[model samples]
Target: MMDSGQNKNETTCAAAMNHRVTCNTFEPEGVPVQVRYAIFCGQSGIAEYEFYLSPTQHGCVDVQLDWLQSAYHQVLQWLNLELASGVFRRFLCSDPHNQAPELEAHAFSNPKHDDPPCAVSWVGQPPLPPAKVVLWAQHIDDPKGIKIKRDGATLMLDRGDLSHHWTTNATGVRKHSSFDQTQCIFEDYEQYLGKHDMTLADHVIRTWFFVRHVDVNYEGLIVSRRELFEKRGLTSKTHYIASTGIEGAPPMDRAKVAMDAYAVGGIDNKQVQYIEALDHLGPTHVYGVTFERATAVSYRDRKHIFISGTASIDPAGNIVHEGDVSKQLDRALENVDALLKQCGASLSDMTGYYAYVRDPSDQGLIRDRFKAILGDVPVAVVVAPVCRPGWLVEIEGRAIIAENNPQFPVF
Candidate 1:
């Protein structure tokens, strides 16, 4: 029902993280493919949104699910902001080239895409359209010192001692073993952060596991998340949380495993840090996996970073450009730009990066190699599958630089 209304293919002025937001790019005028996004607006009025939808008018996935439900309710009615978190990348079993089953709101999955980015719509065969699809969403701008809500599948954001979460579809209560349902889903994520008293080795930063047969249940979801992060103290001498188990099929058929988490509460553990170049990769518990290929928090102006689920491997971690998917995506973007230069941030201060493809004909050489060096810096390609198998491709991200540092405070 988007009977025309939406225009603006430019609006740049992102000296963000300290100017409190101003970075946008849209192209809705009749919207026939090619939409970009960006917006930082940090500090008190907290803001974030970065989309990358590229379809090129081959329309009909019901006109790209009505241009993703009219750009998600036109950004909740033109920039009032609401969707606190998101992830939508398609083209697996794809095709919903419509003849009937239409009406998609958050788009993808002729039958769903990502609670991991779709809550209902995860077909196995019978849905159509998808010669290509790309999306990676996120929206926010909850001012008045913030405080947004929604708890059954979670999406919250507060600010007053901090508290931001995005807890999608954390399945598995019982259906037998995939390692005791990932240890009862990490003991219900430490009892949902002990009703807000927080914990999970002090507030998880990022995690997205979706295992259903990830080469046979990713070793029981990595030995039940490393024995529930070594009974909550995350070991290997402490610290581990920043992940992406990969391969998804989550429609919860007795849940083999499904999760999505991003946490935060308060801060200063010295504004958290754990990004390491380690001479370009190695230290995911040296093979047994624990997680943390990237993580940086800081805040007083900026510094975010995230980034897990990278591939290519080397520096002793083995598997480097084996079957060569363009030299394993240039050694997984050179180990994510050397883990964003160990915190000084790089890769042109990424605000978006996502490319997980395990052969969908290597999606046109991963879209001409991320449009020749991330032209407009916002990439989202899907088809997921990289839990190893000589890794064909993988990459995950988030970045926000700036930083003035007045002893932490504005996140």
Candidate 2:
């Protein structure tokens, strides 16, 4: 008897075929499959596929691989059929979450060949036409965080919070920084940025300020930081760089600030364009560029805008809309919306958001407002203080415009 969610037609046919051949014959139509793929940096392509028992049916439910050796031929035939569907250049199939009782497909790599680690499995396949296929054994230490083949030839490790990266094929760690230096500010970085064909003026798109004792005459510190940038030939005034400054105890308990920058030469869209205030509104503090704060960086093909760290402060360096965090938050959201609109996008198009609150207690209040404003968007909320003691909240985001709209690319 087949289960309700099982492939009833396939299973029934297999059963008939089994009876005609031998009662012990193996069958291939007894599993479910899932697939995903992406191309990065216009070069490397990654594809993944998973096979498992159907939700409503049970096949080889309690049997281990050792018991299925006699039926290897049937399993191989099924795998071949999966390959014929033409979705993957590389194939990866396994029991994710290890829900199975015992054994899985053949491990992909052998450690003896100096290949990355792979898992031991009962089924395996070599690279197929159009692309190479390598098997990886799931990382046992962190099943979810690591992927490796038995031979160690194929391996993918998750580096969380360490950095954001695209494809190694296009760029290999092009930008990086560490807080090990005695001073947060680097002198004579020209020799350094030149080595990578980048400079302060090229693509320093975003900035983050983490300093100590930020509440002690913080405005003075902001001016000093800006001067430092100017000394490096990076004029903060007209640079059009997005910035963020916050007070945090770094590796050293002293005042230290770091920056993350982006650079791409010969790119005009990369050139900064300042958004102006409405003709009669003096200067719109709601969206004017400011120092010691993270700014938004956008690409031409992608409608999504990336706003660094935004807080509740108006022009003249006065914290406006305070006391009521929600009011302050509303103002900050408006600022973000303005930037998005400048790029032909809207708040509703946002797909990812990060919220940092100065007080943990404000989470509930913020969540209620977030849901009401965002209406079920993907978001992560954390509690972290702003560089100013009086500031209560800071929020940043990444948004993507809808597909089929000629204006932007799918993020």
Candidate 3:
């Protein structure tokens, strides 16, 4: 017979979208690791999770209370650990660290798709005590190494890589989808949040939504997305968030939706603060005309450029050299060149970028163009329709400047 209050693996189903959650027992325990299947389904991800508990886990309460409280608190401590550690630093610090955008979120999203969510408990607990962090999110695991905070500014780097393996027929209908869009996104996201200590209302700053067919159903998606936010008593504005939604292709031939997101918390740490650009821009030499944005947050001696999505658009926002991907590519590189010069940086300073092509059939042509202009750099390309029906290409990026500038305009 089962213990009256103990949790069985089959006792209750986790919330929906948690498909195939598994809990492993620790023999000579330090920290218990919980593995979820397909937490994030794509190229770069933190697919598995390691969870550690406070020494107090086994001391108090009968079986039921112990299970509930310990699960809750242990999750909280993990999130703080992630935050203290800073988000990007965690990925960079990992062994065989893959700086590729998609690879970054590999270990965090698992159990690709299961109904009613999956969850499990570890048998043995950690011997060490838990350290407390103020104003933390409990739903997400260890924040020690997963946060970006400076000058009173707080940014939470949750899993940022997601992709859809999608293929379009002549009519543009997605023939096969590896996973449903909403289920995949919410499942992985909620699981990450579950291990953190913050309520849904805190720690989420802005969201960048990349949809496979953003151009086709942009308004409908936003309305539905906002409804979900409303259920939590969080409005878009109160979150102090901004979003850029764009269309892009998924990684494989069966994905319906692919998304990458960013969330920030806390205020600027100092009156004179600096912010770093979090997105990736391609290398400058790759295109005939390069493009970049001028807005940045400056702190200390470094500058972070938060660039907007650019395409073959000229200074007038008019599409340049349409129907000729090669010339358009050149024009794009030149734009980037101008922006780098304006910011006192150069092509070598580019951190990362997102390149969207109108047609995947032209990938080879684009690749050659990239090789010619930008040189080989860390970049990811997507095939998607542009925001404007007339535009055939678009790109955007992030860059850094080493010294504080006295001459640039703020905002």
Count of steric clashes across candidates, in order: 18, 30, 103
Q: Which parts of model 3 are misplaced by more than 4 Å?
A: 1-207, 219-244, 249-259, 267-294, 404-411
Better of 1 and 2 by TM-score: 2
Write the residue-wise lDDT of candidate 3 on 1-411 in tens digits. 221232323312221123222222222223222111111101111122222222223322123223323343344343223323312211111111122232222222111211211111111101111211001011222223232222111223332221111111111123333223433454555444444433334533223344555566544445545555567665422332223346633333344444343332222323122121212233321332111233444433345454455557654456778788777766666666666665666665554444556765654576556656665333334455566666666655555445434443221
- TM-score top scorer: 2
RMSD of each: 20.3, 16.3, 19.1
Reference-based lDDT, residue 283, model 1: 86
How well does candidate 3 score on lDDT at residue 282? 37
lDDT of 2 by residue, 226-329 (tens): 55556665553454455555543332222243333333333334324444322211232233334423233333222324565666655555777777789978
Candidate order by decreasing lDDT: 1, 2, 3
Worst 10 residues of 2 by lDDT: 36-45
Error of 3 at 401 (Å): 2.1
TM-score for candidate 2 = 0.49
TM-score for each model: 0.31, 0.49, 0.42
lDDT score, residue 93, model 2?
A: 16
Candidate 3: C-alpha lDDT: 0.36
